[model samples]
Target: MSEVPEVRPPTVTPVRVVIALCLIAPFVAMLWVGSYARTGPEFIGIPFFYWYQMAWVLISTALTMTAYQLWQRDQRARAARKDGASK
Candidate 1:
């Protein structure tokens, strides 16, 4: 049988880093906004602190979706490599 060429999967560190940043950025922003609650006016009819935290709910969802996509891609690549090796 012909030897199957070794397939090197793309590095996932960057994807993980991006996901981490996505998760962290909103949290940091929320904290900053919360700190302003002692002084700042309401945001979009809601309290600054409340809206800030609520904003993160959507951001977290998006970040989770991104992470999931990255994981799925990695899995598909691994599966393809295995399939190739068995051929």
Candidate 2:
């Protein structure tokens, strides 16, 4: 009897795409906002450029947190699959 090769399950490509977008969107938004703010006036009292960069700092933090959470979830799922396969 010939033995067939084992096939690995397909990866969650969509979820990975979503995670990448979530991580990249904020950075892209920040860049757009920065370029616009460079030519614009101060918002209320703060300088336009300064405020724009500061806003991005906060946004980047949020994006980083989201990425971390997604990575953790992915890791957990992978671990669970590994554990199941080992059983």
Best candidate (score: TM-score): 2
lDDT of 1: 0.71
Cα lDDT of model 1 by residue, 1-87, tens digit: 996677666665676677677667766766674465652467867766667677778888887788778767767878988898778
Q: Best candidate per lDDT, number?
A: 2
TM-score of each: 0.60, 0.69
Model 2, TM vs. native: 0.69
Which pairs in model 1 have colliding backbones?
A: none
Residue pairs with clashing backbones, model 2:
none
Error of 2 at 33 (Å): 6.5
Full-model lDDT for every candidate: 0.71, 0.75
